[model samples]
Every structure is written in structure tokens, then in C-alpha cells.
Target chain A: MSKVVKIFHGPQHPGITGNMSVELDLIGETIVKARTHVGYLHRAFEKLVERRTAMQAFTIVCRICVPEPDPNEENFARAIEEITGLEVPERAKWIRVLVLELSRLAAYHLWMGGQAGSTGLYTVPQWSVGYRDYILDLFEELTGGRVYHMYIIPGGVRRDLPDGFLDRVSDVMDLIESKLPEFDRLFFDNAVFKKRAIGTAVIDPETAIERGVVGPPLRACGIASDVRRDDPYEIYDKLDFDVITEKGGDVYARALVRRREMEQSIKIIRQIIKYIPDGPYRTKIPYPMNWKLKAGETYVKTESARGEFGYYMVTDGSEYIRRMNVRGPAYVHGVSLLEDMLEGAQLADVAMIMNSLGTCPPEIER
Target chain B: MCTDNPGVWEYIANWARKHSIWVLAYGTGCGAIEMPPTMTSRYDAERFGLRGAATPRQADLLIISGYLATKTLKRVIRTYEQMYDPKYVLALGSCTINGGMYWDSYNTIKKLDLYIPVDVYVAGCMPRPEAIIEGIIALQKRIEEGRAEGAKKYRENIEWYKKNQREVFGDEMLPDYTWNFEGGI
Candidate 1:
């Protein structure tokens, strides 16, 4: 047997999904053993939320997942909405769905860039990341910030949609929809991606279930699992979309599930733009600092682009949340699932697997 | 001294460095999400000669994209030390300025410059792609003006930096060889 060469994949690597590292003990480029190292990006989100008021906590929760912040905001809002018996307005519900789907689309675009960039296909990142901007423009118009939309707050959304915002959303949807075929030509159907991504890092359905795999990775295993369909939040139950799934349970399958879901996101947004009712965007929320939630415990999950994102909250009838624990999908997939998958895999496939699993470090550590 | 008065060779080197910046984007926090749009197609930072460098050794610019967790700060220092001289550090997001939204988070460090020299700071919770490109332009201008002397500042004040790093990291501080500038790894 060849002697093992130990290596760290990131906290600083371009190939790494985020600010997390994997320790790989390899022999001839095949990983013999893999261990994950986190806390490189830990901001101790769980601890910080316990001290802040409900309104103050809302602003920070989105920071938990950089690629998809809305899911966190949605889950946080929904958790309180459930715990306190708060009611979101009808218009706010539709707008929240629009925001969630838009963020999901933006995340998938970002994921495509990561997945494609990992295989050294440079053009796909350029195309996809650029297209993601159109959605961001819509977000900026609606929420006034591009990356972190702090719009989906406690009772409802922060404000009403801008005039003609739906029209703009539709236009962006049209543009992104029009470009999907070109992406298909360039990436999904590309021979190079298929050869490299297929059969590399296959997650069998049993293993996927055993590991508590969620989101696209779970669906990619042919299990058809999704939080939106299973436990619908916001207007997700009302919206029509499939839990896009694929067999083979490899990097390509995960990529396909996300790619197909982009259309469903566009479709959902189109429906939202068509069916949304006009009224007060948000119900009256209590004072920002002095609001106390009812003493209760609740768990809420949303289908983030990565998979199921959840927040478990306990309020002791105080202005501050008694406890808020995040169940970010990466917590499962990034650590244990990832280490298991990396064993015997080529050194190169490390990045590919991480992207396929949608392992965001912030979520794992938060 | 080079920060104030650049020799003829220094001017030429700075000119090259200003034009062709190889960025090793250390995605330490949430601000990393904006980097793709900045580097890839939408903003296309390459038009300004800004591109992603795979490793620290090959990089001229280091972007601390958001709040530096104490653990990440150690790695950032190691990364900064591994990079050759004349390198610039561009700090993105308000987190690096004053811990941004993560100020209360125990693990996160408030100011980036306390641990390493920062040449430019682009402030926002997460600065937009345009803002990041503008920050890159600012760094480029600083390089051309011979004002972006972060690496030199780091070398000169390594003691203070190490002290601050040690304070936060306690016994978990990085190995000395990583920051031993005169020893020359």
C-alpha cells in the first residue's frame, strides 16, 4: 500500500464551497480517510440570537446562510408566527413566496457556477452568476438590498412591493427562462461535466436517508423529499411546483434537480405575480425592542436552495428569545455525510461533492 | 519608506501590480456571496485586471470578505504571511469594520486590521458587486500611488499583530514559522 499524504482542502481554497476545511488522508490521490474542520467561519449565531429581541434577531438570522438568506428569514418569521399565533397578511404571504422562490432561483444559479467552476468549466459560472443578477435587481427594487434582503420580518414582509415590481419580476423570469436551454447546451449536456461528475460521489438512497440528507441531495437520491412539499411554509402549499428529483445519486443528479427546480421557481414566481392580492403588506408588529413572545417552543423548516433549513425556538415570555437553534442542512451533509462520501474518492472530486451537497459553512457552524 | 517615496524599479513594479491583481478571495464570512458576481460575468472585475488566484503564493490581493472568526483570523494570518510582499488586503462588509451584524457573536473578531494590515475597507452588511469592484479600483489606485503597503506594514508591526492575535487566540496561536518574516519561509 502507498503511504498516505494528508492534506487540508480549505478554509482558504478556491475549490472549497465556503470557509470550511476537510482533512483528507490520501494515498495516490484517493482519499483513505476524511475529517471535516469547522469554526473557521463560526460567528456563534445560536448564542447571539438568544440575547436579541425578536425584531433584532430577524436581521441577523439571514446572515446564517449567505447563498439563501430568505429561507432563514422565512423560518424565523414562521417559527414566531406559529409560536405567538401571529397572522401574516394575505398580500405579505404571496410576496414572501415570491421572495423565497426568487432567492431559490438565485441560489441555484450560484450553485451552478460553483458546480461548473469545480470541473474547470469556466464559462458556466460567467453565464449563471450574471443571470442571477437580474433576480438580484428585482430584489434590490423590492427590498433595497441585493444580498441580504432583511424584508421578510416577523408579522409579515417589511413593506409592500414596489409599483410594477411584478412586471419586472416577470421580465426577469422570461429572460432567465429563455437562457436555460443555452445553459443546458453548455453545462448539463456537456460531455466533460458528465464524464467527471457522473458516478463520482454517488450517495445511495439508503445512505442518503440514513444520513438525514435533505434538499436537492436527498431528492437526487430518487427519494423525492422536499420541505416545501412535505411541510409547506409561506404560500408554498398554494404554489404549484414539483419536487424535482433524479436517479444515480451523484453530482450530476444533484445538479439536474437544482437545474429543473429553477424552472419551477420561475413558474412559481409567475403564478405569484398573477395571483397576488393587494393590501397591507405586513400586519402590525410589536415594538422592536420591548416585544415579548408567548412562552412556547416551535420548529419551522423551509426549502432553501440547499435543502431543508429549520429553526428551533424556545421563548420564556421574555423580550429575548429563550433559545433559538438552527438546523441548517449543511450541519448534516457537510460534516458526517461529507466525510463518509470522501473516503476512497479522488482528491479532485472533493469540491464536486461539497457543491452537490450544497454545503454552506455558515449554516453548519451557525 | 516605499509608501512615501517609490524608487524607479518600485514604480514599474507597482504599475504592473496595480494593473494585474491576482485576488485570493478568502471567503471568511457572508460577504463571500458577492465575490462571484464581482469576479465572474456580471461585474467582470477582470476588466480592471482583477482575477481569482488559486493560492496565497500566487496572489497579490487578499480580500477578507466579511467578519473574521478568531479561528479564520489565524488562517488569514497564515495566508497573509504565505503571500509575497507588495500584497494588498481589501476588507469587505461592515463586519470587518466593526463586526457588522455579528458584533455580539463571541467567536467573531470586530476589526480585521487588528490582526493584519488592511489597505481598503468596503463597508456594508455585505457590500454589493459594484462596491467590491469600486474597492478593487481603490486598491489599484493605491497601488499605483504607492500607498497600498499592507505587506510592509505587516512585516514592520508583526509584533503588535502577533500580540493581538495571541490575545484572541490564547494558546491556540499559529506556529511562529508561519509569521517569521525575516526567517523567510
Candidate 2:
């Protein structure tokens, strides 16, 4: 006879990706069943957005996900821009690409830390997170806020690049690129990480597609499904980059996909700095407090550090929004997909698999 | 041993507690993002003897990072009660102070101090690493002055705090394990 002991994995767990919990039924060290519980980080962003004007909503959307917030900002601004048919300046397009790529690089660095930390390689976190400050420094220089940069507004970005900002961005990109080899030695190339990560939480291409998995997790299955490459929003089509993919759909495969994408992000940012044309950073919009978009609805998605981060917005020809719904990657990855993946798996691999999937709870609960 | 004042052991204990603050490695809300940078290299809060403790039982400080939903408020209470005595709470963001941005949102609570006794409130939409470190320094100062008695305040006014928590939690109140202590935590 098998006895099942129940345990809750989070809500306050260091191993948890964010403010979430997983209820597990374990027969010894093996998980017999798993259930995901949310609502820990719920702030009702959609409802709050509906009550605010278009301009005000753009500022708060970034709060939907903490680690990588630009995707939310991009999605919200792009949605409003699409609804109003606002023309973004060409230079602003390039600058938007720069911000998005930098945010992606910062996110991947944080992810590297989390992925390594979960596998017991503690030194990686100390290095990766420490170095991520360089990017935050650039963000602070550009947008004046380190973590939450309300820079990407509706028409385009909020402001132009500060003098010599591009040079600093280039410098930080170089620094992060130079450090990758050492990170590889400590994390990706390490024997322990390799042994624990490979062939674990394998998600085949067919299942990945069927379950609506997006971003690097989908790329790990050799699908090469990048929203940047596929949909070509903003200046993505103009930029030169590859949709990096891998064959295996395991933890190692996802990690490898992320590692390669970090290089691609650096390349994209380098190209943006090289070719960003001089022009107005943002187009003049109607006064923010009284601004109203035509009664219309649009769905926009971005290639966040997670797979696909989306916002479905409806405006009623007034300052207030009719409806705004978020389609976060974590809703699927953190909740349903996680429960299915956790069955018959070792408890030790739970955090590893969660990190591999990039399951963020704020996105799920938001 | 002097019960009132001037005890060497008490002075040493306060000094030790002031210097080394073990924060619970729990990310409650959006403000949690700044924590990595604060603990990591650039800001390097470890230099100030601040680091993450895995569980509340081991943690000397609980930082309420941002606005809390009523649902999370229950868990926060349970976690707070589970921690040992001499613990402090640092509520971050204007959300904890007066619901900064989400003042109208139904799910999030406006004032954090109503439910939990906060030792320090770092005011910002999302405070910078320097600001968070400043808050920690302030907390350290309070601990050294023997004024950061949040846990003691919580223990003594458990009924009043429970009343506010119950108002927020309604019928979904947490079990009174910390108060009863029948089976011993």
C-alpha cells in the first residue's frame, strides 16, 4: 500500500519563482499529484486599468509582472497606439527596440540566477544578479527609475535618449557579453547543473504547441516560435536576429535556448545603437488626463522574458476602458502545465522545472 | 542580573540583532523585484548584515514588499505568527502606506499598518536599492535604540490586530495556533 503525504510548496518559499504555492501529494520523494494555487500576488490590475484613462493605465501595466515589466508596458502602449492609429516616430521605434532588448537581457540575467540557484549553484545568483545592476544603471540613466521605467508611453517612448546613453548601453552590453563565458563555466557548463537539468521535465513539440506554450520554452522544442520573428511588431522586422531553437524539450534545452537568446538580445541592442536614426522620441498626444481613444478593442502580444505576454483591451470612446484582460504566459506554465509536469516527478526537481518553465506568479494572478 | 536596565547581555543581544537582520526570502508583490539588486552585488545589502532567511521561523524581519490582497493578508498573518519573537516588519512602497496606486482596486488593501505593525515604511512606487538600504539602516538604528518592538506590539495587541484581520478576512480567518499554543509550535 502506498501512502500519500500532502505538502504545500510555496506562497513564501525561497524555491518558488514568485508569490505562489503548489500543493503536492508525495509518496516518499516522488510527487504523486500536484495542484497549483494562486491569488497570493493579486492586485486586480485589469479592473484598476479600466477605471483609469488611457495614459494612466499605461503607467501601471508594467506592474503586472515584476522581473520583466517592459513587455506589459509595450503591450499596453502598442494596444492603445493600435486602437488610436497613432504614428510612432521612426527613431522612437528603434529606441523602443533598444529598451525591449535591454529589458530582455536584464530578465535573462535574473533568470540565469534563479535557474542556477534552484539547482544549488549559489554562486551564480551572486554573480548574475550583481552584474544585472549595470543594465539597471542604464535604465536609470534613460528612464530615471531602475526597476519600473514608465518610459514606453502610448505614442512612442516618453523621452529621447539622454546624451551618450547609447554609449553606456553599448558598454553594459559588452560587459554582460564578456561575463557569459565565466557564467557558462559556473552554470551552463558545470557538471552538476548538466546532470540535474538534462532530460528532466521534457516537453515535446506537439504537447508544447497544444498547451499554448510560447517564448523560449516553445523554442526549446525546436519549434523556433518567437513572437519577435513571427509577428514582427515595432522595429523587430528591421532588426537582424535569429530565432534560436533547440531539439530537446527538457530543462537543459530551455536553459540553452535562453543562453543563445541572450546573445541574440545583445546583437539586437548593438544593431539598434548602430542604426537608430535621429528624430522625435514621441508624438504629441492629447492631454493625458482627458485623453480618450475611439471605441475599439485590440489584442497585442510581446516576446517577454517569458513566452508570450498579451493584453486584450477595449475602449468605449471615453477616458475609461470597457475591458482589459491580460494573457500572461505564467497562467498556463505556472498553473495547469506545472501540475501536469509535476506528476511522478522527484520533489527535488520541482523548483528546477519551475525555473526552466519560467513560471512567474504575478503574471498568473494578475 | 538587573531586570530594568544596564545589562551587558541585553546590550550585546540588541547590538547583535541590530547588525544582523535576516529577511525572509518571500516576495509578496511587485516591490519584490528590487530585492535581488538590494541583496546582490551593486547595492550589496549583505555588507550591512542583511540577507535572506528561507523560512519565517528563521527570519528576523518580514518586508511587506507591496500592496496585499486580503487573501494574502491571511497568509502573511500566519507567517508572522510562525516567526520567533524579536521580529520586525518593513513595509515597502506607497501601496503599503496609503495604497499608492491601487487605492481604488477592490482586491488590494490600502493601509498595511492596519493589519500588521510596521517598523519602517520605505515610500516609493518602487523604491530604489539605495532607498531600501536606507530603510534597513533606519531599522538597524531602531533595533539598536531598542525601539523596534513590532513583534512585542503584535503579541500584546494580538486581539486588536486579529479584529482588523478578521474584518478584512471575514469568515476566512486563519487558525489561532499562535495564540492557543496547545500542541506547541
lDDT by residue for model 2 (A261-338), tens: 999999999898888899798999988888878899889999998888888888889988899999999889988899
lDDT of 2: 0.89
Runs in model 2 with CA error above 4 Å?
B1-6, B182-185
What candidate 1 gets wrong by more than 4 Å, as runs, is: B1-5, B181-185
Among all windows of 10 consecutive residues in model 1 chain A, the one with the lowest summed lDDT is A231-240
Tens digits of lDDT, candidate 1, A1-366: 799898988878889998999999999989999999998878888888887888888888888888989989999999999988989999999988989989989999998998999998999999999999998999999999998899998889988887888888888899999999999999999999999988988999998898899988889889988888887777778878887889999988888998899888888888888899888888887777788799999988888888888889999998889989999999999999999999989998898889888888888887
How far residue A27's Cα lies from its native spot in candidate 2, in Å, is 0.6
Identify the candidate with maximal DockQ.
Answer: 2
Provide the overall lDDT of each model, using Cα atoms, as 2-decimal numbers.
Answer: 0.87, 0.89
Comparing chain B with the reference, what is the TM-score for each candidate?
0.93, 0.94
Note the residue pairs that clash in candidate 2. none
